[model samples]
Target: MAGRRNGHAGRPRVGVLALQGDFREHAEILERLGAEPVEVRRPEDLRGLDGLIIPGGESTAIGNLMVHSGMLDAIRSFFYQGGAVWGTCAGMVLAASATTGPSQPLLGIMSALVERNGFGRQVHSFEADLEVKGFDRPFRGVFIRAPYFEDVGPGVEVLAEIDGRVVAARAGKVLVTAFHPELTDDTRFHEYFLREVCGSDERS
Candidate 1:
């Protein structure tokens, strides 16, 4: 999936948080898929990026950086301005409306409540073949110390799940995945994200 059709001019320039996460892999995937992916660190870094990806890592650390660096407010404002966002793993937790964890700052964009490391520890990482809706084949979902959406509201659309739990969802310009789609060989998830969320201005 590709964002927009106005030639490369309309192609989205995506940013992956490089503060402290698996951002390099995500950047590689986004670049390989044709989107201009950049690394984001501070509030100043948010400028010029069409959309952003909060990668999988220590959520609390990312949250601290958001508050200390003013990225939390910046990101929220970005969302209010119709910007597209994709969150993977810990990023999903930060994007959720609520979380069942200790006190920590959050961007809190999506209308979903998440549980941190709800799937277990990093050593418990596992792979699953997901039957994601709107895709032709099963998606190879990689969950590593992942967070899961425990309470999803009506505004959200459960795009992919496992054993009746949400692992990936979408709402308007916001897209999130509890598992790492950037880790898998299949590019369908990124493709769908680019075509649907990033390229959606025309459809709207």
Candidate 2:
């Protein structure tokens, strides 16, 4: 926990995988919470990061780059050493052990079996008011061709859902969400990730 009766605490550094999309917004949110968020593009970027965020993008592209740059092993190493990680939207896809389509390469650090595009096609992208645990008001989720979680491993904990489908999950220090939290100003989920995974300072 960060020191403070009500502000961030400690020298917390987080990394956002930059091999994809929507990382900047996540970084900006982290900055607003007084965390140092770095853009991670290569295996070298994994060093010194307390936590990592895999942003929403094309998961296949991100996975391919991670393999080519030797970052897939780097990420798995980070978690092996007890480092924390968060995955959102495309990130969730990258974290899964099994996905709906071809067996794409991944960090495979999470205990999830995910279904890509389970939420329908691009035109089916829609917003829904969600009630997430640990958040006060209903959170509006932005699902842009979002994937949904299915057949999670025993270690995973469901955090949020819609229509009986799992949208968010956490297992130990790993957090994943099928929606784009960065697309909204709602900071609860980010704060939760920071506290649980990143161990960043708290906000007032």
Candidate 3:
């Protein structure tokens, strides 16, 4: 099992899905957080990693690429084997069990119904200070053609919402966020994934 190294003696190895958008941003954040960020473009790239982040991009494009690259099943297997996974924006859409509007490829690990571009189009993009659970204060959420969960299953925990729309959630080792945390200077979200989710306690 590619589970988290809870008692590891060194920095945790984290993988960023580089098949799509904003991966570099995530990698940079991980580096700043004292983690060794690995760019995951193939199944082999997931080996020895404690966690993985699926970055925001075109859902259809990322999904199709995953299918073509054999990453869909690879990631499913990785998660089932106890790997922690976080999805942002379009990445959140890919993690959903079901999505409103046209169907697309999904990881279907999270028991949530999502709506693509729930907030509206690019012109409708906006920002807000979100009250994230367990956070000291508010998190600056940047929504760029983001997706929101219409409903989540009983096992899923709602982490943040705006106007009753679920924008962040977690189910077991999986985390999903509708907004782009990497766009901000705040490293709280990334730190949360590393320490809270991935079980890494190392600090830079």
Candidate 4:
């Protein structure tokens, strides 16, 4: 799972899809973690990146932008080539193979079914400490107009859940979180994705 080398001085280059979402938040977090984060607005912006982050936003809007920009296939191809992808909130919806409550665009990267805004409206947003599989301590999860998985495929590994509801999962090199981990100070999730999913060296 070695990242495709882009000669960025040996640091792994991660791209944050900037079409419609809190892409800047994710990019800032990546920079603080010592990884170069590129804001990707076009399909060509995806080239030579080690990994990608699809941030939370309006799912339909992001999907429409992706299709219009002709980046849907490029994203799917990147995952097929062993690249790590982390999708949060609306991103979770985009990565799923199937979704509930009317159809939307999907990259079909992960074998799961998601229900958009499963956590209710923005007014119902909440925060909770999540017990993830590989984490020793609970990770703070910020749910803002989040989505949850109703069903996961055989290959998917459920990571974090709240009240028996699945909120985080991973399949192959793909990682998905229903809440916004980027909104918090905790960097464990990002470290896990880089070291475990992408097989890249974790920076201090």
Give the candidate number with the greatest lDDT.
3
As for lDDT, the candidate ahead, 1 or 3, is: 3
Which digits, one per residue and each the tens of the lDDT, describe model 4 over residues 104-175?
789998888899999899999999988999899999999999999999888898999887778999887789
Each candidate: RMSD: 2.6, 4.3, 3.7, 3.3
Per-residue lDDT of candidate 3, residues 75-94 (tens digit): 99988777888999988999
* lDDT, candidate 1, 1-204, per-residue tens: 344333357457888888887899888888898888888877777776667888888898888888888889988887776667888998898999888888777777888889999999988999998888898888889999988998898778898887778999998788999998878788887877777887665221
The CA root-mean-square deviation of candidate 1, after full C-alpha superposition on the true structure, stands at: 2.6
CA displacement after TM-score superposition, residue 60 of candidate 2 (Å): 0.9
By TM-score rank, best first, the candidates go 3, 4, 1, 2
**Candidate 4: residue pairs that collide:** none
* Candidate 2 clash pair list: 9-201
For model 4, the superposed segments whose C-alpha errors exceed 4 Å read: 1-9, 200-204
Q: In order, what lDDT does every prediction score? A: 0.82, 0.82, 0.90, 0.85
Error of 4 at 116 (Å): 0.6
**Candidate 4 residue-wise lDDT at 7:** 41
| Cα-based lDDT at residue 118, candidate 3 | 98
Model 2 per-residue lDDT tens digits across residues 1-204: 642212335647889998878999999999998788999988888877778899988888888888888989999988777678899988898888888788888777777789988898789999999888777889899998899887788788788899888999887778899999899988888888877655633111
Q: Which ten residues in a row have the lowest lDDT in candidate 1?
A: 1-10
* Ten contiguous residues minimizing lDDT sum, candidate 4: 1-10
Model 2 CA deviation exceeding 4 Å by range: 2-9, 200-204
Q: Model 4 RMSD to the real structure?
A: 3.3
